[model samples]
Target: MLNLSSHHLQTIQAHAESTYPEECCGLLLGHLSSDTKMLIEVLPTENSWDGEMVDVLQVVDDSSEGKFSKRNRFSIAPQVMLKAQKNARDRNLNIIGIYHSHTDHPAIPSEFDRAIAWMEYSYIIVSVRQGSACDLKSWTLDDNHQFQPEEILTVSL
Candidate 1:
């Protein structure tokens, strides 16, 4: 189970809502701090060289009325990914995982998600429906490209 405090969860929700109509994406960087638990410490670094170029992700736009549809979606600009990595290095925080929002799907990894997942790290998924975040889930890809649930422990501010 991904153990996130209400605060962390709310932050994710806010980010998702803020990016409604598009799949909002970011990285969760922190440390394990133990053998079996992940401690998320921050949201995507806007000023971090490694994360600066990552574009805010979004899914298909709703044709009926300029909005997000109930489709599985996610995106991350390559520049942002590189900047996020650099930001992690500068902060001495190892990127234990990443995060992205699904416009109308469950907070579960989709087939595309699995295909791109990397082991040794976690992927956080937030589900948003009509501009509201409904759920959050976490997964880790194995050698066979299968997703497995992972535990999380968001640290206090």
Candidate 2:
């Protein structure tokens, strides 16, 4: 289960809505208990998916011929990941999860998301319907690399 304040959820929703056609991405900094993750901060980021770099995403096939955009793809740069790690370490928080938005789609994990997923990290996805945020969901990768629905506990501040 993932525990986060309503404010955190709102921030995610707002980011999704504001980005509209383009998808938004970000990191979740928090503490992890036995089976629960408590969010401490929601760090929104720019969508830096250049669509030319399939190598980073471990795409062995040349399926993508550089025809993608922020509307359908999102990527956090390695430098951003390293910097986020350092910030979390300094604040004694772990990067418990990552979050992104799916424009005009359900808040469900896509094939691409599953392919790039890492273990022990929650993934939050928000669906933006005609520029309106809706249907937020969280997921975690299982032993078989399948995405399992994660329970979200919205707590009051």
Candidate 3:
């Protein structure tokens, strides 16, 4: 399960609403134990998938849709993730999860999400409808490499 403070939850929701029609991505820095993950911070990052550039991901996007669509894809630069990891380490924390928005869709993991997810990190999906956050859910990968629903416990700051 993932436990996040109410303030962080609001931050995530606001990020999702602000990026409506395009997916927003971020990192969750926290401490992880055998039974629970405590989220301490939310670090929003740019969606590198739709950035102006000719790259391997852009080639894949072109073959799939003829144009890049932030609604369907979200990417974070390696440097951004590395920086976040370093920051977490400096704070004696770990990157325990990630959060993203699903514009006009349910708060559920897509096939692409499953393909890209690591084994132990929580994946939070927030659904944005009409520029508002509608639903939120968390998921984690099981031993079979399939997504399983995870509980979210909101704590008062």
Clash count for each candidate, listed in order shown: 11, 0, 0
Q: What is candidate 3's lDDT per residue for 74-152, written digit by digit as tens?
A: 8888999999999899999999998999999999998778878998899999999989998999999999999999999
Error of 3 at 125 (Å): 0.3
> How does residue 76 of candidate 3 score in lDDT?
86
Instruction: Give the 10-residue window scoring lowest on summed lDDT in candidate 1.
Output: 49-58
- Candidate 2 Cα errors over 4 Å, as ranges: 54-67
Best-matching candidate per lDDT? 2
User: Candidate 2 on 1-157: residue-level lDDT in tens?
Assistant: 9999999999999999999899999999999988899999999988888745555664633476465678878998889999999999999999999999999999999888898889989999999999999789999999999999999998975
lDDT of each: 0.64, 0.90, 0.87
lDDT of 1 by residue, 1-157 (tens): 3445667777767887887756676677765554443445546423221222222222212233322222444555567778778987897777777777887778888766776567777788888898888888888876677898776666454
RMSD of each: 6.6, 1.7, 2.4
Query: TM-score winner among the candidates?
Result: 2
In candidate 3, which residue pairs get closer than 3 Å at backbone N, Cα or C atoms, i.e. clash? none
Q: After superposition, how far is residue 101 of candidate 1 from its true place, in Å?
A: 1.1
Error of 3 at 69 (Å): 1.4
- Clash pairs, candidate 2, are none
